[model samples]
Structure formats: structure tokens, C-alpha cells
Target: MNILFIEDDRMNRRVVRDMLDVAGATMTEAESAEEGLQLIDTQDFDMILVDLRMPGMDGITAIGHIRAREDEKAKLPIIVVTADAAVDLRDRCIEAGADDVIFKPVAMDALFDAMGRLLARDSDGMLY
Candidate 1:
């Protein structure tokens, strides 16, 4: 599957990229929300992984833009990755249409499992 990853931290980006690569998925990386949005406009990806705490146009905003698109692109799966493990934060992301949320200091197994679940969800259109 082709995945777009939006992350600002260099180390975190690298870790996620490596994990995705090792998982055998092709990935495209974006260091900021603007870049991520631009990529969304220009390419096709099976899924998107976004970081919540970014300098500008955070993950929530990014998801909004994606969902605002026409029907075809709007159906893409979006997962929010954040260090904030607060209950309310996860709730907010879910309410805003995020498919899933992952905690920071990312665990390889956790990420893989979450990615698999998100990507392999049934055709019934359930986000998670």
C-alpha cells in the first residue's frame, strides 16, 4: 500500500518511515502540513498518517481538508499519531474523523498492528 506520512520531527519521521518500509509498504514523507496537503492534491495514497502537534495547520486541520475533497479522495483512511495519550484528545480525533490514533515514542509492533487494522478494515466503510 502507498502511505503518506506527515510528521515534523526528523527522528520521528525517520522511525515511521523505517517501520513502514520494513513492513513492505511504499511511503511518501512530508515534514509539515502544507507539504502534506500538497502531496494529497498531487498523488494517490492508500492511507495517510499525520502527527497532531505540528507548528502549522496541525493534523486535525489536515484531515479536515482531505475530507473536504470530492467523494473519491475523501474516502482515504487517515490516522493521527500523537504523543498526547489523553482520553479527550483521542475522542476529539475520532469525532473529527480520524481512523485511529497512535501514541508517540512509537512502538514498531503497535504501529504495524494499527496500520494493518486501519488499512485492512472491511469495505463497509467503517474507519476502524
Candidate 2:
């Protein structure tokens, strides 16, 4: 599957990249929300993995913008990968249009499970 991963931290990005690579999934990395948005405008992805915190245009705002787009790709599954596991933070992400949230450091199995579930729901037309 093609996935877009937006993260500001190089180390975290590398870790996720390696994991995805080993899973045989293709991924495109974005260093910031702006870059991620630009990529969204031009490419097609099965899902999006976004970091909650960034220097500018945080993931929540990015999710809002993404959901606001008129294209069908705007409805693509969005999973927040964040270090913050607080209840309010999770609520905010869901309210912002994220399909699911996974905390860091991300476990490979959980990441794959979340991706699989979201992709399955999306194919079954059960995702909103």
C-alpha cells in the first residue's frame, strides 16, 4: 500500500520508514505539514500517518485542511502517530478527522494492525 508519513523528527521518520519498508509497503515522507499538504495535492496514497506536533501547521490543523478538500482523496484514512497519549489529545485528533491514533514509539505490529483495519474498513465502505 502507498502511505504518506508526515513527521518532523528525522529519527522517528527513519524508524517508521524502515518498518514500512520491511512490511513491503511503499511510503513517501514529509518533513513538515506544509510538505505533506503539497504531496497530498499531487499524489495518491492508501492512508496517511501524521505526527501531532510540528513546528508549524500541526497535525490537527493539517487533518482539518485535508478533510476540507473537495477531492475524494480528502477522505482517505488518517492515523495520528503521536507521543502524547492523553485522553484530550486523542479526542482532539478524532474530532479533527483522524481515523485512529497510535502512540510512539510505534510498535510494528500495532502499526500494521491499525493500517490493516483502516484499509479494510475503507474498502468495505464503513469508514467515514
Specify the highest-TM-score model's number: 2
Prediction 1 TM-score vs. true = 0.92
Point out the worst 10-residue segment of candidate 2 by lDDT: 119-128
- Give the root-mean-square deviation of each candidate in angstroms: 1.8, 1.9
Q: Pick the candidate with the highest lDDT.
A: 2
Q: Write the per-residue lDDT of candidate 1 for residues 5-80, one digit (tens) a residue.
A: 9999999988888988887989899999999999988999999999988998988988888888886778788889
lDDT of 2: 0.93
TM-score of 2: 0.94
Cα-based TM-score, every candidate: 0.92, 0.94
Provide the lowest-lDDT 10-residue window in model 1.
119-128
**Which residue pairs clash in candidate 1?**
none
